[model samples]
Target: MLLVLSDEHKEHLAFLPEVDSAVVGEFGRIAVEFLRKGSTPKIYEGAARKLNVSADTVQHGVEGLMYLLSESSKLMISEVDFQDSVLVLGFPEDLNRLLLQLYLDHRKEIRQILSELAPSLPHYHNLEWRLDVMLASRALRHQVKPTVSLKLHLESGGDHIARVLQTDPATLLHLIQELERALAEAKTNHCRRILRNIK
Candidate 1:
C-alpha cells in the first residue's frame, strides 16, 4: 500500500532520473515514495496525477514496480500470502532489515554521520544524535518488548560519557558517577573518623 507522499519522500523520488529508463525510473520513484510513506497508491490515479500520464500508461509502469518489489520480497526470509484475493505478509519481525536498507538508500548523510562525526567528537559531536542508527536500534529494541530501556535511562549523562569514553555511554557514565560518589563518601568518612577520635 502507498500512502501520501511527504516533502522529503518526494525530494527523494525526484532524483530517480534514468537516460534510457524513464518508465522504470518513474516506477522506481513512485514505488519508493509509496514505501517511505507506508502506503501503496491506487497506481493509475496516483501515477497519472503525479506524471500527467494516461491511466493505462501508469498501470504499465506500476506492473514493473510491483514486479521488482515482488522479486525482492522473495529474497527476504519473510513471506507474503494472498487471502480473499489480497496480498499480505508474514514474518513482520525481520522487516527491519528491509527498512534499514531503504533508510540507507540516502547515503549522502552517511558521510556527515559516520565519517565526519567519528573524527571530531568520536561519539556524537553535540549529542548522541551522532549515532542515530544506535538510537533507532535502541528505540526498536524497546518497542519489541517490555524491559528497562537502556536508551531511556541513559538519556542524560550517558551521552556526555559516550563523548568522553568514546564507547558505551551508559556504562561509562555509571563508572564515572561511582568514582565521584566514592571520592565524596571517602572524604566524609575521613572527617567523621577524625572527629570521633578527637572527641
Candidate 2:
C-alpha cells in the first residue's frame, strides 16, 4: 500500500531527537501544507507568511524531513518530480509481495479452505469435518521426541475419528497425505449410502 502522511503527522515526527523541531514544525506547517494539497509546487513565499519564518528556513527544514524519510526502511520515496512537484512514497514491490504472502498464510488460509470444501457439502446432511493441525511445543523433555499430530473429526459430535502421530517431519507429511486420501474415499462411500437409501 502507498504511504500517505499528513502535514500534522510529519510535524509529530519532528519530535525525534535527530530532527530540529523548530525547523520541522515550520516546514511541516508551510511546505508540507502545499504537498498535502496534492501538489509539490514551490511555495516559499506562502510558507514564510504562514509560519512567520524566512523562506530559506522552510526550505532547509523540508530537506531535513526528506533526508530522514529516505533513510527509513519502512517506506521509500520512489519519485520526486521536480517539474510537476510531487512525492510518491510506498513499499517496494518485493516487500509488498512478501507481506501479501504472509497475509494469505495467516489471515486468508482458513477462508480459502472453506471455499474449496463448499461444493462437496450439499450431498448429505450433517456432513462436517474438523481438522486440528497443530505443531509440537518447543519445550523439551529428556526422552520425549518432538512429534506432530493431526486429529480428524469426521462427524458432527466432534469425536476425533482418526488420530495420527509421527516423529519425523518428512514422514508426518506422507502420513497426512495418505490420511487425506482415505478421508476422500470415506466421503464418497458416505454419499453412495445416502443415494442408496433414497432409491
Candidate 3:
C-alpha cells in the first residue's frame, strides 16, 4: 500500500532536510516515544535546544514523522512499499532509506502500542424486532397503523447492552432501505480500494 501524505504533513516534515541525519534518527525515536507515552514538552524543549530550532518546529517534525510511521504501520505496508511512499516526499535516497529502516525497526512495537490504545467499542451481537398493527380503532372504524419495535443487542468487553427503539413502519422501511443502499455502496470497487488502503 502506498501512503498518501497530506500537504500539511508534507510541510511539517519539510524541515527534516535541514537537520542532520543523526537528528532525524532522534526524531524517529521521539516519535515512537510520543506514541508509547504521551507527548512530553520537556523532551521537545531539549530537542529544540540541541537542534537550535524552535520547539514548535521540533514538535511538528516529530508529529509529521509520527503520522508517517503510524499510517504506514496501520496499513502494514511492505518495506519496498514504504520506501516508495517516502520517495514521493522528495527526500534524498539516504534519508528515504533511513525512514524505511526506522519504520521496519519499530513497526511491530508501534502496532502493539496502537492496538493497546484502540478504543474498545461495542459491536453488534444480535437483533430482535417486532411489528404491531392496530386495526378498527374506536375513533376510526377502518383505521390501520403499523409500528415497528427493534431491540439491538451490542457486546462490549464481554457485556451485552440492549437498546430498544420504536418507529412507524414507514420510517422503519425507509431506514432499512437506506442501510441497504449504504451496504451496497460500501461494496463498490472505489470503496473497496479505499478500505484496502486504510487497512
Residue by residue across 65-179, what tens digits does model 2's lDDT show? Answer: 4433332212322332211111222434443343233222322332343344445421222333333444555674434444544443343343334434335556767878999
lDDT tens readout by residue for model 3, 27-63 = 9998999999999899889989988989999999999
Q: Where does candidate 1 stray beyond 4 Å? A: 1-20, 38-53, 76-199
Q: Give the true-structure RMSD of model 3.
A: 3.0
Error of 1 at 112 (Å): 23
TM-score of each: 0.23, 0.21, 0.79
The candidate, 1 or 2, that scores higher on TM-score is 1
Candidate 1 vs. true structure, TM-score: 0.23
Q: Which stretches of candidate 3 lie over 4 Å from their true place?
A: 133-146, 187-199
Over 4 Å off in model 2, which ranges? Answer: 1-41, 74-199
lDDT of 1 by residue, 117-138 (tens): 3333324334322232333554
User: Model 3 reaches what TM-score against the true structure?
Assistant: 0.79
Strongest candidate by lDDT: 3
- Best by the TM-score measure: 3
